[model samples]
Target: QVSSGDSSVVIDKKKDRRIRPSVVVAALRAAQQREPKFKHEAFIESLALAYDFVIASKSMRPGAAVKLLDVYNVLTIMPGSAREYTRPEFARDIYLLDQSGHVTTKKGRKMSLPASALTRSGGVLRTVTRNGQAKDYAGISFEEPGA
Candidate 1:
């Protein structure tokens, strides 16, 4: 298992090999199970590993745009587990990360932003209109729990 602080290794490994689909799914499931004790950090670490695995693996079906739902489906299929492992919030997190260009597929395609960047920058900004007035709206602020 990869340590939380060693995400760089995971990212680097993704660039070199084709990870197995089952390994990716297992990493995600492990992250979900460990979330309660380790909090979001566990999720982040697990996410990095899983993302790397998915991108490096060709078993995800060729030409199919990898989506968070696709990852979630794998999480939902774990055996002997009754807990809800998949959540829209988690999927959104993955989507935002992908949008940031930090993660990438095996084909050298970028995915999204790094979690650290999102936490430090207060997230992506957007334009919002209310009462015919347009204003800049800062995206959601993501902080690790208890931090």
Candidate 2:
């Protein structure tokens, strides 16, 4: 299968037959579902196929960002009355930076990352919840795992 700008092709060399249009559509749909973040145009460009023999060409959706995890182990959720620290809005959005240097916006997703996920430099911005109230514990320490 090959796709170019506004064009695509599926070569069946064994039979030298063109793939059925419906099958092609199904395959593309499956591809998108399996990996929505894959760039459609880039896939076509990688194939380096000509459009003159393209059996099908349809507008494909751009890659979508998938939410995974958030950075910063703590967030300040206090309304107004701020000091100099991470903003409260940072608590609302889970900022996940993938290995590929791409960020995924995870709105409405709470940052429930494990303590091990954090580092001296980064992790999910966290605040301890006590008595149904959240409190910032900037200079506190918890027992290490198996320690």
Candidate 3:
């Protein structure tokens, strides 16, 4: 029998339970079916969509920020949406950017970007928090992606 945290199983004279390759493949297939396919465009679209909301918020309050969790919530709650931004792979995609760009997730009561970030014309994107918790506020001031 398999034991938790143990990679090797103790085989007895009467018990021989070996996992087959077919079993592994079947299990992987099932998991793949249950999860949404990772698409770069979909991930980018989600960010862009969240950026729109951030822009609106900034218009109301200068230097306002938004939470990444809020962006994930918005993407998942859309009607007829199939993209799953909650998946670790999808989430990791956001963290992939050029040297000049970065996404920050911090726990604090206040969130702000550096003044130098503002000079980019394309503002930096960051998630805001309050009381050391994420809030529904992602800050955006950067140029659109690919612009």
Candidate 4:
């Protein structure tokens, strides 16, 4: 707001909190940090496919699970993208998948990934949980959704 006092013009900004939407958007964009684009369903589905491939070749049963390393190998073997799929990313995805409950009957359909699925069989895929707890999962098993 502007006011004419004597021979001088005074401007007051204390009450002017309004800003143009475009300007605000520009400011926000400039200050925004890049976030990871983790596609939950796609990534998880890829993981499940890789696991299936590994499990089938190994002739794994419901009580048995393919090694984490084996699954990772299957996923990275063909190099689907230019950016390499790192072990850390694989680990994080697994953790996120578990937390999502998408593979269990509790949430996603036609799958039951019990705690036994993540039991450490041999070598481990160490991951940090959503709550920041360090976890190690050696293998993964998939069962009937209602199981």
Candidate 5:
């Protein structure tokens, strides 16, 4: 059993090179049962790690903002590797992170994405706004979270 705080992954055999999908699903289900509110906790943690990487490199400053697209890139695309965490999926996670972040779908977390001024060519996220345009939450703000 490999345990990290409340999350635990128990495999019967440690030497097995190829694990079964059912085992993974079972572990995940157990974790969810343990804590249902933090549904998107992995997404939030990954985003925070990526954001910290960008900040540490001085691509952005302390108490400053980083582009959401950039964070997605750093998280998904490594120097010599690639991943399939698509932008639309990232956008959805971001939307949920804002809506039900702090509590079990009740409060929000410390992270925030303030509005960004976009030009005609500025990046746009499909966060599903009622209006034609969504004021573009193009960047993420760590300042508000007291970075």
Candidate 6:
């Protein structure tokens, strides 16, 4: 069995290139068993590597950091270098998504938070009164255990 760590390497055989679904499932199961000890991103990254998935990036360190941040409910689908759009609506939506725990940015990576995290982070909404009044409200913040 291959040990789990940064220095570990997986050598795939060209003759037996068939992907074993069971191995992938087993890796995921093992990861799930250790879920409590890992953040969402760490769990996924560990499982992905356990199944021999290659994380493409400049270096393994950054790749791991990106993966770790992913478990924290940050979405980095769109790169920071993405072209800036002047539309207020689009900008507002992205900001709302970022604030609502749906997405988070760190070190140039976008990560998605689990639904449980999203619900816990609180919802974002704008209230408008019929009497031509509008108010912006911030949602309650949920602190993680030991946070």
lDDT of each: 0.38, 0.29, 0.39, 0.58, 0.58, 0.32
- Tens-place lDDT per residue, model 5, 1-147, is 445554544442223222456877665455434422435667676777787788887766665667777777788775543334456556756776776654221123356675546323466666543232443457775543323
Query: lDDT value for candidate 2?
Result: 0.29
Report the candidate with higher TM-score, 2 versus 5.
5
Q: Write the per-residue lDDT of candidate 4 for residues 1-147, one digit (tens) a residue.
A: 223333322111122232555654454344333333556677666766776788679777653556777878887787563135667667767876776767643334343333454463455778656455797767666664555
Candidate No. with top TM-score: 4
lDDT of 6 by residue, 1-147 (tens): 232454332322112222366765555355434423214444333323322222333333322322222222232235551223222222233333444553222222334322333334444334333233443333222222232
Return the lDDT, model 2, position 34: 48
Candidate 1 local distance difference test against the native: 0.38
- Candidate 1 clash pair list: 97-112, 97-113, 98-111, 98-112, 99-112, 100-112, 100-113, 101-112, 101-113, 102-112
Instruction: Mark the regions of model 3 whose C-alpha exceeds 4 Å error after superposition.
Output: 1-42, 54-63, 79-83, 98-147
Candidate number with the higher lDDT (4 or 6): 4
Rank by lDDT, descending? 4, 5, 3, 1, 6, 2
- lDDT tens digits by residue: candidate 3, 18-82: 44657645554554345333454444545655655755754634234444444555566766452
Positional deviation of residue 6's Cα in model 3 after best superposition, in angstroms = 17
State which candidate, 2 or 6, has the greater TM-score. 6
Model 6: worst 10 consecutive residues (lDDT sum): 9-18
Ranking by TM-score: 4, 5, 3, 1, 6, 2
lDDT of 2 by residue, 7-30 (tens): 556432112133568867666455
* Predicted candidate 5, C-alpha RMSD: 11.2
lDDT of 5 at 5: 55
Judging by lDDT, tell me the better candidate of 2 and 5.
5
CA RMSD of all predictions:
19.3, 23.1, 14.1, 15.3, 11.2, 19.4
User: Which 10 successive residues of model 2 have the least lDDT summed?
Assistant: 62-71
TM-score of each candidate structure, all chains considered together:
0.29, 0.18, 0.34, 0.57, 0.55, 0.19
